[model samples]
Target chain A: MQYIYAALLIYKSGKEITEDSVKAVLAAAGADVDDARVKALISALDGVDIEEAIAKAAFAAPAAAAPAAA
Target chain B: MQYIYAALLIYKSGKEITEDSVKAVLAAAGADVDDARVKALISALDGVDIEEAIAKAAFAAPAAAAPAAA
Candidate 1:
């Protein structure tokens, strides 16, 4: 949803993903900001590797799967 | 967000997180399923450590942050 997208946007911008930053992004997007959800997201993302998660998302197809040995 | 929740439910159930499973979960929840989004989520989570990711999410607080030296 917009909450996760907001976090991803902050991640992509190389800015620290804090509650305030996420709220700012959501606000700029004209999305109704939910404070509790934003807080939960920031907490849930604690110690998560945003770069790795995003990289995985970028590989959005079975073609990106590892090749089988011939 | 329901899509992500569906995937998480599959994950938590110790079942394989396939397109079918994800769709089933969403369907059971009476949520309108989006095929493309489910496909993308499966692809995105292909190499992700879901256990590790969930563990990180379990850490949901600033108090979970590393302690500052007194």
Candidate 2:
């Protein structure tokens, strides 16, 4: 979880999301940095659009299931 | 990023984190789900404490530094 947060921190800062960047953030935050998790996070985020993902999370909650009237 | 959000969606719903569950959430939201990315996300989050991650994110910003001790 912290691994992901590290990646988010890097992404939010408009910096390139990389293993080093994540590790730096984790180190700065005084959190235990797991190499395996960091590597996995960087791998998982490959090809993922961080901006799009943030946008999706922004409207994650779906509205009522009521039918719309024409 | 959406993959992370899908996992978060599952976590938020108190459901077990699984590729199928994450895919389901993405499908419900009408978003494209890359199977490889979903698989990687599930792998990355393995053994991770989602609750702790959420808590960390909540208090992500560090308090301002000040001299308090006399």
Candidate 3:
């Protein structure tokens, strides 16, 4: 089976930001430097469908089949 | 400023999958395990807006101010 690695790009106000902004923040925060990797990541972000990605990432609780007795 | 770390959860067919699936794949792949972190990540994914997140992540080429003469 294929494998995928994902992460969250959270903003300061608890809002989600674009991958670019996330990268910028990571750079500003002094994460390791890998120019090639950064470029690849940016390109991937550009190509990704964020909405779909989120949907895939989200978890929904299973509905109860029957109510509990009082 | 607060920092957010994000990753892409890729599927076998080159399609995006949910975080749980991604986590499962990763687990299957023998990546390091962190149950607490996984739980937090799943919860965060539940709260995110994928569409908005993608829009934020997308990059649009700046319209050219002027075309160069041939």
The complex in candidate 1 yields a DockQ of 0.01
State in Å the error of residue A48, model 2: 8.0
Candidates 1 and 2, the one with greater TM-score: 2
Report the lDDT tens digits of candidate 1 across residue range A1-70: 9998888888888899998999999999999998999999999897788888877776643223323211
What stretches of model 1 exceed 4 Å from their correct place? Answer: A1-70, B63-70
Q: How well does candidate 3 score on lDDT at residue B11?
A: 20
Give the best candidate by TM-score: 2
Candidate 1 docking band: incorrect
Stretches of candidate 3 exceeding 4 Å from the true structure: A1-70, B1-7, B10-20, B60-70
DockQ values per model: 0.01, 0.06, 0.07
- The CAPRI-style docking tier of model 3 reads incorrect
Per-residue lDDT for A1-70 in model 3, tens only? Answer: 0111222333223443445444443443334435566566656656666545544523222212112221
Question: For candidate 2, lDDT tens digit of each residue in B6-67?
Answer: 88878898889998998899999998766756766787699999887666544532221111
> Candidate 1 vs candidate 3: which has greater DockQ?
3
Name the candidate, 2 or 3, with the larger DockQ value: 3
Rank ordering of all candidates by DockQ, starting from the highest: 3, 2, 1
